[model samples]
Target: MPIILLLQLSNQTGLLSLGDLLLQAATVLHEGVVQVVGSSSAFAAIKSDGSGIIWGDAAKGGDSSRVEHRLQEGVVQVVGSSSAFAAIKSDGSVFSLVSTACGGDISCFEHQLQEGVVQVVSNYLAFAAVKSDGSVITWGDAAKGGDSSRVEHRLQEGVVQVVGSSSAFAAIKSDGSIIIWGDAAHGGDISRVEHRLQEGVVQVVGSSSAFAAIKSDGSVITWGAPANGGDISRVEHRLRE
Candidate 1:
C-alpha cells in the first residue's frame, strides 16, 4: 500500500516513498489518522483499525520499535508523559515505552497492568492509571508520582478520579475525601490542609505545584507549594459559605 506522502525538494516535489520506512503505515492512510499523541520528543498515531504507528525521537516514546509487535493491532489509546508513552489495548491491558528513567520502563508493574485498565493520565515525569475496579496504579519517577505506597490503602477502593501535577497527584474518593501523594514540595504533601480535605471534596484540580479542591458546601481548599497556588489567604473571605 502506498500512502500519500507529501515531500518538497530543492528542484522537485512529490510523495516520499516509505519503501523502507513503514510497512503498514500506508495501509492505514485510507483508514486515516484517527488520533495522534506525542511526548517531549516523539509522536504516535492511532489508525482506524486500532493499530499504532510511532515516529520521532526514540527517547521520548517516538520509537515504537520495542513494542512494535503489540502496536500492530488492538491499541485503543496512547498517552504520553514527558519522556514515555503508555498504550491501552482493546482488552484493557497497558504497554509503555521510551526513557525508562522517566516512565518508559514499567516492567515492575507488569502483573498489575496485564488487564482491567480503564483510564490513564500523566504529567511530565510519571503515569497513573485507573482500573475498572476504581483502583489506581502509578509508575515512573518516585518523586514525580511513580510511588503511591503512603496512600495505597486509601486508593484501594471507591476512587472516582485522579488528577496530576508536575510532581504529584490528588485523588477524590467516593466518600468525597481527597488523598494526595508524590513530591511533598509539589502538592503531594497536603498535611497543611488535611482537615479541609476530610470530606465533601467534589472536585480536585492542580497546577504544576499546587491543588485546589471544591467542596459540596460551597467552600474551597488549597495546599501544596504556596507560591504556585497553595495559599488562598488573600481571597479567603470570598471562599467562605
Candidate 2:
C-alpha cells in the first residue's frame, strides 16, 4: 500500500484519521490477512469480511476459537494486553478474547461486561473497562494493575477517564478526583500524594512507571518511581507558576 510505504518516509506529512486507517486496513485485508498488531503480548486481525482473527501465545490471546460465534461479525475494534485480547463491538460490548492464563477467559466477568461498556484501557498485563454508569471493571495479572480491590469503592461510579503506567492505572472521576490501582511499585500507590488528588484534577499523565496529575488550579502532583518523573522535587518550586 502507498500509505504504508509513505509512512516510512523520513518526511512523512499529515496524520491519518481513525476512519482513514480503518478504510485502508479494510482494503489491505482483501487477501484474508495483512494488518497485524501486537500489545505487550498477543495479536489480532480483522479479516476481509470484517470478522476478527486471533493467533499468538494461546495463553495470552493468540487463540479465539472458544468465542468464535460472537466474533463472526461486528467486531469494530480489537486491543490486547500481555494476558488476552479484548474485542469491542458496535453496541458497546467487550469480548474477553483468549484463555485463562492472562485473563483471556472472562466467563467470570461476563455478566459485568455484558453491556454498556464505553471504553477499555490496558497496561502491560491488565485491562480496565469504563461503563456507561461510570463504573470500572478490571482483570488480568494481579501485579500489573489487574486487581483493584483496594480502591474498588471509589471506582463504583463517577469515573470519566482511565490511564495506565507499565503496571498501574489512574482514573479521573467526574468530580475531578483521582483513583488509582495496580502495582504500587509502578505508580499504583498514591498514599503520599493522595490528599492533593482529592479534587480539581483535570488530567492524569502516565509514564512507563510513574504518573503526573494536573489539577484545575494549575498545580501538579506526581508519584511512582522517582527516577521516572514521579519525584519532581527539584522543579517543585518552578511548578508553582
Candidate 3:
C-alpha cells in the first residue's frame, strides 16, 4: 500500500512496536493504500494488490504474521471486532486472526465459513457472518453474541440482514420475523416482546445494549434495557404522524 495510507493508520494511535518499520516503509512507498481497519489495540492495512499488514499490541489483533500467506492476495474486505480481525477473500472464504478471546479463532467453524459469505458484522466481542445461502455463522465470547445456538434453528435460512448491539445480535429474516441472541441485558433477549416481533418488521437498528425495530406499519418495537432505547411508549404518541 502507499505510504499515505500508512500515515492515516498511524493517526489512529493504535500502531505500536512496529511504528519504526511502518515509518521507514512510508519513506519509500509511493503506491496507494487500499484499505485500513483497526481493532481496539491494533490496525490492519491492505495493499493495492489485496494483501495486508498489521501492527499494534499482539494480543489485541496487532499481529497478522500467522495469516500473512493467506492475506497475500484476493482479500476483498476486512473487519475488526473489539479485539480481533476477520478478512473476507475474493472466493467468499473467510479468515480470522488474533485474540481468540474475542472471536479471532475460526478453526471450529471452518466448514461453515469456507465459502459463500456475503456479509459480516461484529460487536464488542463477537462476529456474525451471513452466507450466500442465507445462513448465519456466529462466534466469539458467547456472552457477547458469539453463541447463536440458542436461536440456531431460526437462522437456518431466509435471513436477509444481521445487526449487532454491544452484547447481542439480532437477525431479520426474509419473512419479517426477528431472531435475537447474546446477553439479554444487551438486547439479546426479546422474549418480553416476542409476539409483537413475529412479522411485518422492515428494519432493525441497535444501540450499545438495546435494539429498535421499525415495522411495515411505521410503528417501532424495542426491547432490551429500557434506558438503552428498548422502550418507546413515552414518545409513542409523537410518532403517530
lDDT of 2 by residue, 194-233 (tens): 9999999999999999999998878889999999989999
Local distance difference test scores for all models: 0.83, 0.78, 0.85
- Candidate 3: TM-score? 0.88
Instruction: Specify the highest-lDDT model's number.
Output: 3
lDDT of 3 by residue, 138-172 (tens): 99998999998889999999999999999999999
| Model with the higher lDDT, candidate 1 or 3 | 3
Question: Please, what is the TM-score per model?
Answer: 0.86, 0.80, 0.88
lDDT of 3 at 113: 92
Which prediction has more favorable TM-score, 1 or 3?
3
Better of 2 and 3 by TM-score: 3
Compute the lDDT for candidate 3.
0.85
Question: Candidate 3, which segments miss by more than 4 Å at Cα?
Answer: 1-20, 25-31
lDDT of 3 at 150: 80
Of candidate 3, the 10-residue stretch with the lowest lDDT total is: 1-10
